[model samples]
Target: MKSLFVTIVSLFSLSAAYAQTWSVDKAHSRAGFTVTHNLLAEVDGNFKTFDAKITAAKPDLSDAVFEFTADVNSISTDNERRDNHLKSPDFFDAAKFPTLTFKSTSFKKVEGKKYKITGDLTMHGVTKPITLDATMTGPVMMKGMGGKEQEKAGFKINSTLKRSDFSVGTIPVVVVSDEVEIKVNGEFAKQDGAVAEKK
Candidate 1:
């Protein structure tokens, strides 16, 4: 009976020791995406305004909880007219649905610093299931430009999505690939006072 009590205490302690929380630092972070323009060309773009919140239970990133939002008006392709067109009713309709959002449902760790992040992507009044293949880098301790810092984390996620799934645009057997390839690289600062930080 005494052995069982000791074992239970030890297991609880280990569970408590492994949980942590982190925050997305926008100033030091970025959100980007790419799509085919007019069927045959590649256009690179990014959202200048966005926010994110993240939580994790371990360095492995399994069971990490996260949510991100991008301001639809902040979309930029480095051109004015095309940007305006994209914002119009034919495309994003930013006036009606002004933001793109993602919220994680689950995270499953894969081999060697990689994870499968499954989530819901809400855009243009539609929400769809999306999974990003993610790679984690650097939870390494380092000396800050100002002082000592511990475990800085960064991630890269790549996925190919069909815009048609979300009713983004219609293609009538001409011009572009309905499948769009997108990649997002993010850097997060360990948020102080985050409840998950200790995990």
Candidate 2:
């Protein structure tokens, strides 16, 4: 009986080890955020250029990983002045801290297509732990420029955090929302094979 139990456990472990590993496709993915303005409406914006590394494996998403970096100057709001101001000392201070980053520490499945990701996010030279809810949008097929067949998976992640945690809090505290909402339109490409194996 013990031998059988050990064999089963070993097989499960082997299966789990093969489940997660992927390369993020920058072209179809996004790292964006929205903040409330004057207590009325939310202003939407995004980082024009960035890169991500992600993996979706392990039945529990225990082997998942996420990392991304954005160019400070690439912030887009379709308005020049406001965009410039965001790069100023009062806000992002682009010249000093030119990039923002996030690295996942945990992932939990919540029903079908729904997941919760907890990770460390760094901005303004500060790092803090944050959790975001993500949903698998779907899958698609694409052809590369060289005619190579490619498969893509999409996920939408949403999360909120207090700006002060990363030291971006500079407003009167009453006017600006302490919490910032982030949305990610993320896509991942298969790394040769599926991450299959449940442990």
Candidate 3:
């Protein structure tokens, strides 16, 4: 019994030691979306400010937790008028809900470098469960300033959600499609002192 208890404690410690936290390199990351406009053209926009983090124990990130948040007021589509409207009550009501966020509940590997992530998304004072398709690349080592070697990874995530489900927009479907497509591309850097074994 004593040996078994010691072995279990050791295993737990090893697993905790292997977990790493990777932070988004915002200068190289983007959170963007597209929605059909007038049943003809598509309007694209992106948030100017957003942050994300990933915590995982495995190099492949088979068991990962993801958290992301974006400032709703930083939304831009190039046209100031439309952007303001989006921030107003007709859409996001940015004053009431200044930020949109997502926290993952599950991260399942689908194939090589591909994963299905399910999470709770909160926006415009509402929360809903959503899933995204994700692809990951590289824990490539790169030399940063001062010639320090750092680990970097890239991710591409995509999802589609109904705007109405989050009470984001009340515009008729004919004017703006109910479906919104989200695309996020991010580069993450492993924080110092949370290093995992190289795959």
Candidate 4:
């Protein structure tokens, strides 16, 4: 009985040692998308307001948990009219559904520094499964502005989703391509505590 108790305690301690919570540095992160417009050129857009975090229980990120959200109203395309239209009922309808979110279900290491992340993406009041090819770099410790040691990590992820799958717009595919390519570039800092630090 004593031996069993010791083994259990040791396992618990090991688990705790491997767990880390990372807070997204929004200032250094971006979530963007691209789609073909009129079959002539690609239109690029980005969400200005967003948040994301990661809870990694393993060093290789095989058991990492990811959560992300972006404000639909913050979408920008560098064109005022197009941006406004995106906020209208013809597209995202920001007034009704103001946020798009993603929650990761699985993060599996596929190769060195590469992972397959599967998650549910919710947008325009619709939820669909999406998979991203992710490359993670560095949980390396470095000195911060004040010379305090900090741990940081970054990820570059790409995924393709059908706009119609989420019912994003009523426009025809010829005008705005049905397929959208998403890119997420994120930099995260280790949380000082269990909760993320507010900027």
On TM-score, the candidate that comes out on top is: 3
Residue-wise C-alpha lDDT for candidate 4, range 90-174, written one tens digit per residue:
9999999999999999998888999999999999999998999999998799898999999899999999999899988989989
TM-score ranking from best candidate downward: 3, 4, 1, 2
- Candidate 3 lDDT by residue in tens digits, 23-49: 999999999999999999999999999
Q: How well does candidate 3 score on lDDT at residue 23?
A: 98
Per-residue lDDT of model 2, residues 1-199, tens digit only: 9999999998867766676566777778888888888887788889998888766554334457777789988999889998998889888899999999989998787888898989988899998888999897545678878999776667799988888888884985556677788988888876676665543
**Off by more than 4 A, model 2:** 1-21, 56-62, 137-148, 173-175, 193-199
lDDT of each: 0.77, 0.80, 0.92, 0.90
Full ranking by lDDT: 3, 4, 2, 1
Question: How does candidate 1 score on lDDT?
Answer: 0.77
In model 4, state the lDDT of residue 84: 100
**In order, how many clashes per candidate?**
8, 1, 0, 0
TM-score against native, each model:
0.82, 0.78, 0.90, 0.88
lDDT tens per residue, model 1, 1-199: 9999999988766655555666676677778767775667788878888988767656655667778999989888899997887778767889998999999999887788889999999998999989999888877676667786756678888898887787775644255567777677777766554352233
* lDDT for 110 (candidate 3): 88
> Model 4, stretches more than 4 Å misplaced?
1-18, 194-199
For model 1, which pairs clash? 19-198, 19-199, 20-196, 20-199, 21-196, 21-197, 39-175, 39-176
